[model samples]
Structures are given as C-alpha cells and as structure tokens.
Target: MRKLLKILSREWFLAGMLLAVAIASAAPNLGRSGGLLHIDELSDWGIFTIFFLHGIGLSTEKLKQGFSRWPVHLIVQTFTFVLFPLLFIALDALIGRHLPPDLRLGFCYLCVLPSTVSSSVAMTSIARGNVAAAIFNATLSTLLGVVATPLLVRLLLGSSGAGISLGATMLNIATMLLLPFVIGQLLRPVFGKWFAHFKSTTNAIDRGVILLLVFGAFSNSVADGLWTRHGPGLIAMTLIGATVILAIVLGLTRTAAKLCGFSPEDEIATVFCGSKKTLASGVPMAKLLFGAHPALGVIVLPIMFYHQIQLFVCSILAQRYAARS
Candidate 1:
C-alpha cells in the first residue's frame, strides 16, 4: 500500500491528466468556445512558450559533450526515430485488422514522437545515469522530431485516410515549434541565468501547458462523441497496446546497450531515454497535424497512455538502478 501511494505521489501529473479528461468530458465546450481567450490560440502560444523555455534551459557545452559520446547518442536517436516506428508498423500489420484505424494510426504516432525532455532527464538522474547525455539526447530528439515526426506521419498514415499534407504540416511545425526553439536558443545568453533561477516556475509552466493541451484534445474528442464512437473494449486494447510497446522497447534498449558495450551509466541513460516518448511535443503536433481530422483526440490517446505508463515503469526501474549504483 505504501509503495502504491509513493508511486501515485511521484506521478501526480497522471492524476492531473485524468482530471483534465473528466473536465473535458463534462464541459468540453470550455475548450471549444472562441472569445478573447480562445483555447486554440492559447494552446498554440503555450506550445511556443514550452519550446522557448526548453531552449533557454539547454547548455551548449553539455550538448557538445553529449555529442562526443557519438555511439550512445546514435543508438538512442536511431531507436527513437527509426526502430520504434518500424516496430509499431509491424505491430499494425499483425493486428491492424483488429483495431480501429484511428487507434492504429495513434500507435504509429506514439512511435514517431521524440523522447521526452524533463521526464527522461529526471529518470536518468534518479537512476544514476549520465544526466548530461540524457539532456543532450532528449533536447536534440525534440528538434529532430519537429521535422521527422511530420514526415513519418505522412509516409506511414497518408494512405490510412488521415489526409495529411506533408508540406502544410512541415510549415506548421517549423513556424510553431522550431522557430520559437531557435529564438529561445538565441536569447539564452541573456536570460539563461534568470531561467535557471526560476526553474520551478518553468517546470510548472511545462505541466500547465501539457494539461491545457490535454483538456483541449480530449474536449474535442468528447465533443465529437469519442465515447460513443469507440467502446470501452477499444480503449482497453489501446492501453494494452501501449503497455506492450513500452515493454518491447525497454527490453530492446537494454539488450542493445549490453551488446554495444555501454557503461552502466550509459546503459541506464539509453534505456530510459530511448524507451520513452514525449507527450509534450506530441499534443501540439497533433493539433497542427490532425486538427481537421475528426479523430484528433483519438489519435493522441496512445501517446497520453504511453506517457503515464513510461513514468510508472521507469520510476521503478530508476529506483532499482539507483540501489545498485
């Protein structure tokens, strides 16, 4: 019982997610209504701010050091961008007929997302891993994802009737995600100290923005009869699918780290960083990528589920690793 409570306390953000979903289900109109404070516009600006702060927090020196560890970086990047997506595609091929089209696409979307930044670093630190490498890889993955995610979606889901326009999607990502990240990096020299001083505030902003995105996406889903269109069975299947994917990725990353002769610290970093996906980036990307589609909410469900699952599982793994270290 104590262990369960500790786990829950550590993962309060997951509870917030549930609350967001419930509120959206009850009053989805709050997210959809347009006024001076439009939710869509707010979500857009929130995404920009999120990446901008991410930029401010990065250390160029650490990033360079992380780059120097080319072998580990390459492995993490390859798994995040290439291997994960192929695994999902294979999963889709095997079980695609059994699942709804939207859910299948959601699985693919979850695969393409970058490794999460804050959580990946936090878990790596907890596990006594190479924190600098975690930071660099996570940051670089987000930047790459701004381009790679959209392109991969176009290639993987274009024929699934998602109506993805590769050019328009790239334009949206570049303007909304990449441009702010670059501006933040440029301004970091001036505001870096201030950003560090208010680290807690920036962290809050990150969680707040994600919750807002969640509320908006789920509200849109609820408004579109998400519950009626898909029964509890499909929801269960998505949960199961997310769990299985995480397990497979975790096993593969650990095995790959061992075979590649990574140090224990580097191995832990690779396992935690490579196995996780970023809901922070995924939500905003979904809005830009699939906003017009009817199943936008459904499309992001797998990512949402996977985020919580990875946190819970990685928390346990981190604890174990720390004990060994």
Candidate 2:
C-alpha cells in the first residue's frame, strides 16, 4: 500500500494532466477560447509569463564552461536538429499521406523542437551524468528553437497546408516569446537570485501555464469535434508513435556516444537530452504558430504525447544509469 501510494504521489502531475484532458473533453465549452474562462486572453498573458520565467531561471555565465565540450555538443545538436527531423520526414513520406494533416504536421513540429530544459538537466543529474553539459545543450537548444523551429516548419510544411505566415509568425515569436525572454535576462541581475530562492514556486507556475494551455488547446479541439472526427484510434496511434520515436532516439544516442568513445556519464547525458522534446517550448510555439487554426489540439498532440512518454521512459533509464554509476 505504501509503495503504491509513493508511486502515485510522484506521478500526481501526470494525473493532473489526465484530469485536465478529461475536464476539457467533458466541458469543452468552458475552457475553449472566448468561452466562459476567456482562456485565449489568459493564455496570452500566461505565455508571456512562462518565457519571462525561463529568462530569469537561466544564467549565461553558468553555461559557459560547457563550451569546451564541443564533441558532445556536436552529437547532441545534430541528433536534435538533423537526425530527428529526418526520421519524421521519412515517416511522413511512408505513412503521412494516410495520416490526418494536423497530426502529420504535429510529427514534423515534434521533430524540429528543442529538448526540455528542466527534465533533461534533472534526469542527467539523476543518472550521474555531466550536469554542466546537459544544462548547456538544453538551454542552447531552446534559444536556437526560436529560429530553428520556424525555419524547419517552413521547410517542411510550407505548401503542405496550415496556411501559416512564416514572416508574421517569426515576428510574433520575437515579440511574444523572444522579446520577453530578453527583458527577463536583463532583469535577471536582481530578480535571478530571488527566483532561485523560490524555485519550487516558479516551477509550479510553469506547470500551471502548461495545464492552462493544454486545457485551452484540448477544449478548442473538443468543441470542434476533434474526437468525433477522428475517434480513439488517433490517440492510440499517437501513444504508439511517440513511444517508438523515443525508443529509437534513445537507442541511437547511446550507440553513437559509445562509438565516439564517450564516457558512460557522457552517454547518459547524450541519451536523455537527445531523446526528449520540450512541451514547455512546444506548447507556446504551437499557440503562436497555429492560432485558432481549428486543428490547434491536433497540432500539439505529438509533443504532448511525446513529452509524457519520454518522462516515463527516461525516469527508468535514469535509475538504471544511476545504478551502474
């Protein structure tokens, strides 16, 4: 009983995520944009706060030391930007014609995204990996994502549908996400230490923003008959697809690290950072990029599904790596 309770307690956030989905599915009218809760307005402000908090949480000086670790960085970044996208591109070629358009684009978005900062670093620490390098690559991946994600989306999905304006989306991303991040960094001199003091509070706020976004996205989808349109099969396929992608990436990262003669610690960091995608960044970007495009929920599903899948798998891997260490 105690062991079961402990497991449940640890996964309460995941439970909350499931609860949010259920609520959104049942009461779609409440959380949908321009609905009773005014989620669209709240989400705009919430998006700003999320990026501002990211800026405050990050310290430039701390990541400088990892600059010397170029080989590891090369492998990690290549896997993130290059290899991941190629896999999805090939998948799109093979099965994309059969998949729903929004869902297919979701996979492309998933491929181009940067990794999760908090989870990647945390998992690396748990796995007894090189924490400094993990922190560096994760941060770099996100910052670069502002440009990389958009460019890759245009490259992959330009005429493929979704009517996205690449130029305008870039401006919105800058004005919405990047600009606030810059402002936050400037203020970080004073606010950084203060935020560091209440890390748990800030972390909660981040998760809170995610829940609100998730609720809003799923709510909009439900109102539009997302489930009625596709049914349960799509969700099942998303879970299976997310699991397969994570497993393949995890295996390849570990193998590549070994081939390059990396230490066991480096391999741990490589696999965890290389395999994961960022819900934190992906959610906001989707909101910015898709914008009430009808398929908003469908577009975010891959990362949403991938995010939880990676967390579950990485936790076990982290434990195993810790044991070996």
Candidate 3:
C-alpha cells in the first residue's frame, strides 16, 4: 500500500490509471443508464471532504499576506472574471461560426468559470511567486464563482440553452463547497494543532479524495461514450486551441501585472492564478449550466486539456522564474 501510494504521489499516471479502472467498472451501464453511477453519493462526499480539508489546511496568515497588496488582487480578479470571458467571446465571433452551436456556447460558458484551488496554489509556489496570494485569489475566485459564473453564463448564453438557475447553483456551491470549508475554518482553533501534527495525513487524504472525484467524473464521461465522439483532428485542434489561449492569457496577464506596479513575485502569481481554469470547476458546472449535451462535454474537453497544458507549461515557466530568483 505504501509503495502504491508512493507511485501515485510521484506521478499522476497512477491516478489516471485508477480513473480508467473506475471507467471500466462503469462500462457495463453504457447506453442503458446514461453514464451516471450509483456511487455518485460517494463522489459527492469525497468532494465535500476535500473541500473541508482544503479549508483546514489554509493558513490565515498566508491569506492576510497575499491580500496585503490590493492592486494584485484587482488584476487577478479582472483576469478571472473579465479577460477570460472576453477571450471566449472573441473566439465565438471569430471561429464559432464553423463550430457546433452547443460547443460554441459551452466554450463561452467555460470561460466564465472560476480558478481551481489546489493547482493554482501549487503553480504559484512552483514559480517562487506569492503562494499565499495565489491561495487567497483562488479561494475568493471559487467563492465568487458560485455566483458570478452562473450569472455571467445566464447573461451571455441564456438564449443558447444554457439553463443556469443562478440561485440553485449558488445554493449548491454553498452547501457542497463553501459550507464545509467555513465549518473547517471555524473548527480551526480546536483542531489546528492536531491538524498541524497530522498535516501529511491530511494532504494524503486530500489527494486521494481528488483522485476519487476525478475517477467518478471520468467514469461518467467514458460511460457516455466520450472518447468515441471525437476523432484525432478535432482532438488536435482542441489541444492547440487550449495552448494558444494559455499563452495569450499568460502573456497578457503578465504584462498587465507588471504595468500595475506589482513586483515580480506578485506578477507570477497574477499571471498563473488569473489565466487558468480547471476541470474540477468546469465539469460539474458544465453539467449544471449546459445540461448533458455532447457539446457541453466538448466545451469541457478544451478546458481540461487547457488545464493540463497550462500546468505543464507554467511549471516550466515557474521553474525558470525560481531559478532567476
């Protein structure tokens, strides 16, 4: 068990394999059951556990330090809430004509979603940037997204069948995401010391829970014949499109951050934290906002591909910055 854990820790391939297993397990229900598994409750519980653990792991001091610079926060906020969606809308005008209507709408809808929590922090830390700032920005982004993403989608894609009930989505996020996080924060005084002692255990559990959620999501995707829908050309185009968006956003955010008088560290955080989206946030939101359409899956496909691509590229960029520092 320790060896397996070590392997999974060292490489994400093990996580991918585990997810594939989950997909295989759900294969028998294809076509008849519509890709949803009975284990959805377990997955939801895992998501809740991860959220709580994340809240507990946060250091208030770190957040305070990050928010010390108001300009940095504003830049990140604009990138996440404004710049991202504008890019999607531009894509809609430019290339959307050739794309399927649902796919185009899904693409636009994805742009309005929030930043991820764990990876944003990790990437910032890797870049030797303001890790604390990244954490705060991502946390706030997710919290804001519970409202903002849906509201933006409703306004932009409402006519395109983006069935977003903003109130219900906010309630869902509050219950499944924010509520546990706040509870953990409230319990921090009593649990902080013990939490510090077992920090490694907590991190392990966090990783495991994330893997479970990933598996559950991918299982549903596979069961719905996701892999069979797109051929190599579309996949390649989607991947290339994601890379372009990543590069464009990173460059634009970096320039804006520098112009805003942020230091190099804050600049890195702003660029990475601002420019990226996540499958963790995008997938479920897609289902909620756009229904179980194939185009919604396609929309999420670019985002997920963009996510991994951004991680890999930004990891290299972060290492470069760290070396320079």
Candidate 4:
C-alpha cells in the first residue's frame, strides 16, 4: 500500500488525467458550456501559455550543446517522423477494415504526431538520461510536426475521403501552434531568469494546462456521443492496438540506440523521447485537421488512450533505469 502511494504521488499527473476524463464523462457540460469563459477559448489560451512557458524554460546555450550530438538527434527524429508513421500505416493496411474508420484514422494520426515536450524531458530526467538532448529533440520534433503532420495525413489519409485540406491545416498549425511558440521564444531572453526561479510553479502550470486540454477534449467527445459509437469491443481493440504500437516503438528505439553505440544516458533519452507522441499537440492538431468532422472526437480517442498508456509504462521504465543508475 505504501509503495502504491509512493508511485501514485510520483504519477499524480496521470491520476489527474484520469479524474479529468471522469469529470468530462460525468459532467461534460462544465467544459462544453459557454458563459463568461468558453472552454474552447480557455483551451486556446492554455495551449499558448503552455508553449510560452516552455520557451521561457529553455536555455539557448544548452540547446546548442545538445545539437552537437547530431547522430543521436538523427536517430530520435527518424523514429519519431519516419519509423512511427510507417509502422502504423503497415498496421492499418492489415487490420484497417476490422476497426471503425475513425479509430483507424486515430491510430494513423497518433503515429504522425511529434514526441511530447515536457513529458519526454521529465521522463528523461527521471531516468537519469541526457536531459539536454531530450529537450532539444522534443522541441525540434514539435517544430517539425507543424509541417510534417499535415503532409503525412494528406499522403496517408487522403484516400479515406476525409477531405483534408493541406493548406488550411498548415495555416491552422502556424497560427495556433507555431506562432505562439515563436512569440514565446522571442520573450525568453527577458523572462528566462524569472521562469527558472519559479521552475516548480511553471511545471505545475504545465500540468494544469494539459489537464484542462484533456477535460475540454473529452467533453467534446462526450458531447458528440462518443460512447454510443465506441462500444466495449472497439475500446478494447484500441487499447490493444495502442499497447502494441508502443511496445514496437519502444523495442525499435532501444535496439536502434544500442546499434548506434549511444552512451547509456543518450540511449535512455533516445528511447523515451523517440517513443512518445504528444497528446497536447495531437488533440489541437486534430481539431484543426478534422474540424467538425463527426468523427473528430473518435479520431483523437486513440491518442488519448495512448497518452495515458505511455505515461504509465514509461514511468515504470524510468524508475527502473533510475534504480540501475
């Protein structure tokens, strides 16, 4: 019991996410209803603040130092951008007809997403890995995803009759994601010290924003009658699929890191960073990408489940790595 409590304390964010999902399921009106503050508007601001704080937390010098290890960066990016999507595409080809169309698309969307920023860094730190390299690679993945995700969706899902407009999707990403990130980066020089001084506070805000985003997303999903469409059997299949994808990616990353002769720290960073997909980024991107598609909620469901699975699984792996270290 004490051990479980300790694990729970370490993974409070995961608990918060589950609670958020429950609340969204039970009382979605809280997030879906508009009054003084609309959930959509709040989520928009939360995303902006999340990225802005991310910018403030970054150190330019450390980023440059991390960049010097190009081989590690190359491997991480290759797994994130290339290997992940291809794996999902192959899976879709085999079992695509078996699953609901939206869920299959969700799996594909999950693959194309970038590695998460804050969580990847946090997990790397927990594992006693190359923290600087994690930050650099995760950040770069986000920037690259703004363009790459749309293109990949077009190339892969174009035939599904999703009517994806590459130009409009790109515009949305630039406006909602890239623009805020750039603004945050520009302000970093002035606010970097203040941000560093209150690191814990900023980290709390990061988690809070993520929770808010999750709540709002699930609220939207519930409002659209997500449960009616996705029955127990479908949910179970999604869980199984997400787990398999994660296992494959984790194994591939570990093997690749070893083959590349990475130091233990770099190997840890590569494996953790390379295996993650950002629900924070993926949710909003889905909103923009699939705007008003009846299946938008369904499309993000895989990523939602995948996010929790990765966190729980990686937390255990991180703890094990820390013990060894």
lDDT score, candidate 4: 0.84
Cα lDDT tens digits, model 3, 1-325, are: 9998887778764466355545544562431224345444565676677678777777777778778777777888898899888898787778878765545665676688888877888878877888888988988898788788878877777566445667886787678777888988888878877889887787677666545444544455555555666446666767777787888898999889878888888998898889878666665555545444434445566776777788788888888888873
Task: Assess the local accuracy of residue 59 in candidate 4 as a C-alpha lDDT between 0 and 100.
Answer: 78
Backbone clash pairs for candidate 4 read none
Poorest stretch of ten by lDDT in candidate 2: 157-166
Query: Which is the winner by TM-score between candidate 1 and candidate 2?
Result: 2
lDDT of model 2, residue 279: 97
As for TM-score, the candidate ahead, 1 or 3, is 1
**How much is 29 displaced in model 4, in angstroms?**
4.1
Which runs in model 2 stand beyond 4 Å of their true positions?
1-9
lDDT of 1 at 256: 97
The digit string of per-residue lDDT tens for model 1 on 1-325 reads 9998897787667878888888888887887535223678889889999888887787877787777777888999999999998998899889988988788888889999999988999999999999889989999898899789988887777676357778888898988888888898899889988879998888889889989888887777788788888879877998999999999999999999999999999999899989999998999888888875657778899999998889889999999999993
How much is the lDDT of residue 53 in candidate 3?
Answer: 78
Lowest lDDT 10-residue stretch of candidate 1: 31-40
lDDT of 2 by residue, 1-325 (tens): 9998897777767777788889999999999988999998998898899889888888877689767778888899899999999999888888888888878888999999988899999999999998888988988888788888888888888686447778888888878888888898899998888889988888888888988998999999989999899988899878888888888899899999999999887888788888889999899889998888677888889898999889888999999989982
Clashes of 1: 0
| Candidate 2 displacement at residue 214 in angstroms | 0.6
Q: What tens-digit string does per-residue lDDT give for candidate 4 at 58-154? A: 7777778788778889999999999998998899889988998778888989999999987898999999999989989998999999999989988
